[model samples]
Every structure is written in C-alpha cells, then in structure tokens.
Target: MDVADGVLVAGYRIVRRLGSGGMGTVYLAQHPRLPRWDALKVLDDRHDSDSEFHARFLREAELAARLQHPNLVAVHDRGEDHGRLWIAMQYIDGGDLAGLIRRGPQVLTVERAVRILGDAAAGLDEIHRAGLLHRDVKPANILLTTDADGSDRVLVTDFGVAHPIEDGVKQSGGVATTLAYAAPEQFGDGPVDHRADVYALGCTLYQMLTGSVPFPRTGAGSVMYAHLHEPPPRPSAANPQVPKDFDAVIATAMAKNPADRFASCGALAAAARAALTPTPRRRATRLSVAALVIILVAAAALVGVLSRTTPSQARPVRTPVSGSVDGSQWGAFAYIAQAFPDLLPGFPYGSGYEELSGCLPQDTKYNNVPLDTSLPIGTLFCLGNRDPVIDLEIVCNADRTPIQPGVALADFPEGDEAWSRPSGSGHLFWGHTTFTDTGSDLDGHTTGVLEIFFDRADRNFCRIQVVGTPTTGADLRAAWWPGAPL
Candidate 1:
C-alpha cells in the first residue's frame, strides 16, 4: 500500500513522506493532540515477515532509544501497528549532510567542518558510553539545522541499523553497513566495537572537508574490499588547507587494524578539538605589530600638534557637544535602516540616542552602569587620534556593557577604527577613518563610535549612532573605509 493510504496512527497525522531508507520509509507527521512534529519511520510489513530482519530492526530501535545525546536524534516512541513496525522521532526541519555537500564545495568552510565533526564525535562518544555501536554512520545520516540567526547545528540520525555489544551476531554480518564508510573490521571475521563508529566518523569528516569520500570508487564490492584491505587516502591530498594533524587523525581512525585506532570516540573528539583551535601565536604577532605601528603614528602626530600650541592651550579640557541629529552619520543610519528594515525598525533615528568624542593623549576611565536588562540597548564610545601621541589607555566599565573589563584599546586588531553594528543592522560598524563618496554629492562615512538601543524583544532591532570629528575632503578620502556592503 502507498504511504498516503495509511491513516493517522496514535494521534500522529502523516503529512508527507520525508524519505525512504534501508529499514523503512520516514514520514513528516504532526501530533493531533499536542503542538509537536515528528519523523515517523514505519517498517514495511514485507520486511517484518522476515524474523531475523524484524528482530534486528526492533532491537536496534530499542538500543537507540536508550542512548541520548544532544547531537544524536532522539526517539520518542516505538511500537507495532497493523502488522507494521514504526518508530517516532524528533522532526528535524533541515535535511541530511549529503544535500549540503551537493549544493557546492565552497559552502563548507574549514571552521564549519571542524565544528560539525566535533559535534558528531561527541554524539558518537555518548553512544559508545551506552555500549552501542552506530555501524552505519555516513553523510546521509547527518542532518544540518540552519537557525534563523544563520548558525548551523548538526544532528546524527538513522540508528536503525546500529548493533549492541552484547548481541551475539557472528563475524560475518547478516547486515553490512554503507560500503564507503564501513570500518575494515566489518568485513573481517571479528566482533565490531566503538572503534568501528569512529572509523565511520573519520570517513564522514573526510567527506565534509574534501567534498568527496576517501574511498570513492565504481563498484560497491570494490569499495567494501578497499575498506577491508586498502589504506585510506589523506584528506589533505584533496584539500591541502586541511591541517596535517587532521590528516593523521583520519588515517589513525580508518586504520585497517582496530588496534591502531583511538580507544574511544571521546579521545577522537579531543583530538579534533585540538586540531581546530585557532593558531594564537600567529594572530597575536600580527595584532602586536599593527598596534605598534598605530601607536607610533599617533605619537608623531601628537608631538607635531603640541609643538604648535602653548602649555596653557595644551592643558587637558573636556568638551561636550550635542545637536539635533542632522548629519552624515544620521543619514548613514537612515540608509542602513531602510536597507535592513527587519533588523532595524523605525529607520534613521531609532528609539535611542548616541554620542561620540575624541580624547587627548592621557589616561582616561569610563564607568558605566549596566543598562536595565529589560531594555535591550547598546552604546558605542570611540577614542580617536586627537593628540597624535602614543598613549596607552584602557576601555572598561565597572558594572555595565557586555565587553569585558580591562580591554586594551590597541589589543583589538581594528583598533578604535572598528565599530560594532547590531546583528540586524544591514550596515556594519564604521570607524572615523573610513568613508566613501557614493556618487551624488553624498558621502558614506564611518563613525568612530557606535551605540545601539532596543528592548529585549526588539534587541535585534537596535539603532547605530556614530560620532567623529569632520576631516578635510582629502584627509577623509585618505582615511575613508566604507561599511560592509549589504
């Protein structure tokens, strides 16, 4: 019978077919009584008639239901109905990793691959801890969830073919796993363990990083034999950007002999984390040099300006300026609000106000109270090269702001020239030094400081205010850096 002919089973209304796998057909169904959606995997009655397959399938579902991990798909219910076996699971809106890889290679960045693999490994580790082995881990079984915020979440699914350690199945399998990802031992005469899952994870990771499987070949039998006898190719051979350590990890996991692999999936995950850690030394060195150059330039300019002024004139003075928001900065906000209406509502001038200032070379401190938590708002304060002196200072708040205390201005690579635009803002933060003439007489200017304010529900709908001293047309052109293009 066709899937559509099936009635609503146990309050679940099958809306459409999700996909068909080796075990059964999965349907996207919703609960009639509760606000819930699920993927219903119904075993074909034909397969259930085979006692061996039915027993294995039911046992696999029971075993998987007992294993719980954030990355692993959660099973909600399992039972037999009208001669068909069915298992209900969480409905993952996003589909599997195979579709993601097929879209394009560039879509998968190194950082993304590392994160996905690390999360998947953590899931496998949990399964290993439960004394079960996911013998059929592959790209098709990994699901990717893309949230409204654009972040990606990975979910491992399809444990219907997994086996428990206590199950006394013989070395020669009744059911073999995906040929391309199956571990060498699956084809050998031995009982498989957690390492088998680790091997499959390695193959999946290899595919994610390189856009192709390590053992991709013509025939299924040929691929299965290669898993049994051939050494897996290094991922870096296909994508050199993959770190050598990652290649080593993959090689060790996919080793023909189980003794050569990591003892557990947890150990493999730790190694993946280490390989993915950003190179701190290189990033630190680059930031240090950039800070030094900025300090020297500011100091030289400060000295030249101080030379022209007397001591009386050089005495430090605080000046506060305010006006009816009518300037290029306001115009920039207006343009941004219009471009990203969803992110920045009530364009141009938002519900809050922002201010900017340039302090002379000296030590200064800012103590701000944490703005009310109920009101979601942000304020931007910028320090510009007013005196052209190499000055060391700290930007901090004793009780307010999300930025941590004791942040050195020069430590940030972009310096005061960097700005933070709210997530929903179509325009990125602009520093005082960046601007561009956008045809017409109008110019797009970057603010030295930006502040956003909004309520909790509208936190994403904050306003960006910029403050900076005007520069000559030529100087502005020289320093002009435009906001990120939409």
Candidate 2:
C-alpha cells in the first residue's frame, strides 16, 4: 500500500515521503488535531502477508514506543492501515550522523565525537537495562540536531532490528548485522548480547574520529575475515590528532572476545570520555619541568599510557611525541614543510610557485631565541609566486600547553597586534600584523599571520604567516592546514 503525499491515514496526513529502504518507508506526516508534525514510518507491504514478519515488526514498534529516553527518538503513535503496520514518530529536522561524517572528520571534533557517542551509549544502556539491544547502531541510525542554545543533540533512531537479551546472548537463527561494525560473535551462531552493541559503538566512534570504518569494505568476505581474525588499527594511527589513550579504548571495546570488552555500553562510553580527555597542566618547579621535558623528548613517538583521574586530582602523563622525523634535532615541521608545496591548493598558483625550506637551530647563545627548556624547536619555509609570498614557521613541543596567538607576531617587525579567536579548526590562532616597516621577502605589504598548532597528542605545532595574503582566515586554514582540526 503506497501512501502518496496529501493522503490521510488514521487521522494523520502524509506530507511527503521522507525515505524508503528494505525495512519500511518513512514519510513526513501531520496529526489533524495536533500542532506539530511527526515522522510516519510504514512497514513494507510484502511483510503484511507474512504473519511472522508482521508480528516481528509490530513487536519492534511496541518495544520502541515503550522506550522514552531523551537520547532515543520518541514514538508518537502506531497503527495499521490496510493490514500494513505504520508508526508516527517525532520528526527530526537535523540530518543523520552519516551525513555529518560524510562532510568530513573535522565536522566532529574529539570532544564532540565522544559526547555524541556517549549520549547514544547512554540510550543504548537504557535499552539494554530493559532487556533489549539495538541490533543496528551505525551512523545512519544516529540522528543529530542543534538545541535552542546551539548545543548538539544526538538521538539514536531505527530499532528495526532490536533484539531481546536472553541468557548471556540472544538466540538467533541468522545474523542481521552491518558487516563493517559487527562484533566477532555476530558473524557466527554464537550467543550475542549487549557486548555486540559495544563493539558496534566502538566501530562507530572510530569512524567518527578518523572518517573511516574499522575494516575497509574491500569485499564482504574480506571484511568478515578481518573482523574475525585481524586486530583493528588504532584511530590515532590514522589521525594523529586522536589521543594515544583512545587507541587502547578502541582496542578494548572491539576485542575479539566479548568478555575482554567493556562490561556495558555505559562503561564503554565512560572509557572513551576518559581516553580523549586531556590531562591538566599544573605549575611545577623549573627542575621538575626540565625533567618532564627531558623524559618526553627521550621517549619520542612512544604511546602515552593514561590513567583515569578526576579533574580536581588530574596529573600529567608523559605523552609520546609522534612524528615522521626522529632525533635529527629538526622536528616534524621540517618534514611537513618539504611537502607543503604539493599539499597547497592548486588552481592559478600551482604551476609557477617557488619553495624554500630552512630551519634556525635553537641557540641558547642568542638572546632572541629563549633558553628555556620548555620552549619547542622551530622551522621556517617560504613559498610563493611573483607576489603574496607565504612564510611558514613550524614549532613543536613535547608538552601539551595551549598555543598563544600573540606568539606568531614576535619575530616580525613590531606592530599593533590584532588577535582573533580560534575558528573552524580549533588549532588555529590567527590574526593580523599591521603597522610594520619590515624589510624581507615582503617589503611593503599588509601581513596576516596565522599560528596553526598541530595535534597536541603528537606534540606538533606550526606558525604560518602569509605576507599579502589575499583571502579570509577560513580560506587560509582550509588551504594550508587541512589536518589541524582532524
């Protein structure tokens, strides 16, 4: 029974068909007596003739309707039309999480990703407590919206494949799970429980952080084999911005053995929050600070083992410095500078650009450069065409202190500093350096400087100042430092 737009069903008028899939067709619907609209989903007609499928569909609707968590999508009404099952649910104006992720990994920061997944995990916990599991917990099943105060609202939708937890795992005749995010036990006729949801949530969080599924969808057979046998790579490996602790969290939640995973979805979410949380920096004696820097410098690219501690009692953990260049005194900035010419956007300026890379060794003998052991090593690169020359300086530190925007204007001729708050990429500390009589590659041109602090977890940072930059702050960030927010 195809319901057309403007058709009335059980006192609800169908505005338009929202979407359709193997499970059912969803439509924008309105209640005649109510003021607000609702999402009306009608189960496929083919299942109406099959009593078993019909019963299962009705059961799912009943179960979902009974669930009333803030994070879970609300079910407004359920009824039958021409022997077909249909449900009216709260209509969400904001698109699904899959769309947000498809935009880019930068759309969801580490903090935002954890909060979204944590909310879904809380909703999943509620479902699990009621003796049920969300069999499908992929990005497509997660809906997103913004609150009146501009805070993100995450809603878990689509309980079409929800299953009851019986004994340790629900008895299932066949697997009905998304292969890319399924647990090992979900592949075979093994007992599946809430742990399956934990595994799927882990996979979802991985995608949210790195914009790629745990296992590449090369082929169905390959994915299945990989899930069962291969250990998944850490998200931090793909996106260095991810904290090292997150690697352990993903590994634990997506363990091949269910028993090795977190105790529950709620526990999994809590672990994720802890893993991504940054350690608080405290004031220490100069000797202690020097020792800490020495330990971090010596550790070099090794993973930092983080322990969970409350904010009031938080302590510093030695974060491993991650970068391609190792121990040559020149930091990762020198390496990235070599690749900056190719990484820059190409249109009118790509064919005729000159690239020059150099670095000033940190000299305690020179008063211009600080002698403080806490200060990071720096590198400089110059790239341009005939005009609007771009000069970039990369700074790296083992410590995770926040970047200061004013620091970018230190070397240039003294000028009135105009600092702007961080924008699209939180790592950017951009501003303008006007009122200067500097004589360099840029002799007589207004200068706009941007300090881009790379991934804190990796301990990489850079200061990019474009002389005669003919673009907005947003454009400069998008073109030069794509991974600043990733």
Q: lDDT per residue, candidate 2, 71-180, as tens digits?
A: 99998878887676888888999877765554443456788998898898988998998898887787877889999999889899888778778645543665576666
Model 1: CA > 4 A from native: 147-149, 173-175, 277-486
TM-score of structure candidate 1: 0.55
The model with the greatest lDDT is 2
Off by over 4 Å in 2: 167-173, 278-486
- Against the true structure, what is each candidate's TM-score? 0.55, 0.58
True-vs-predicted CA distance for residue 280, candidate 2, Å: 8.1
lDDT by candidate, in order shown: 0.56, 0.62
lDDT of 2: 0.62
lDDT of 1 by residue, 1-486 (tens): 236724686667888767655477778888667799888888854576698878877876788789777898898888777777778888899867765543323456667777777788888888878877778887778888987788778788888677776774346543367666788777766677888888888887777676566665433455667787787888767666667668777888788888899887667767776777746565456567778778779989999987888453665321111112222322322222232232221212111111011111111232232222112222322222111111112222222333321222111113222333454322222223333553311145332432223232223333333333332322221222222111
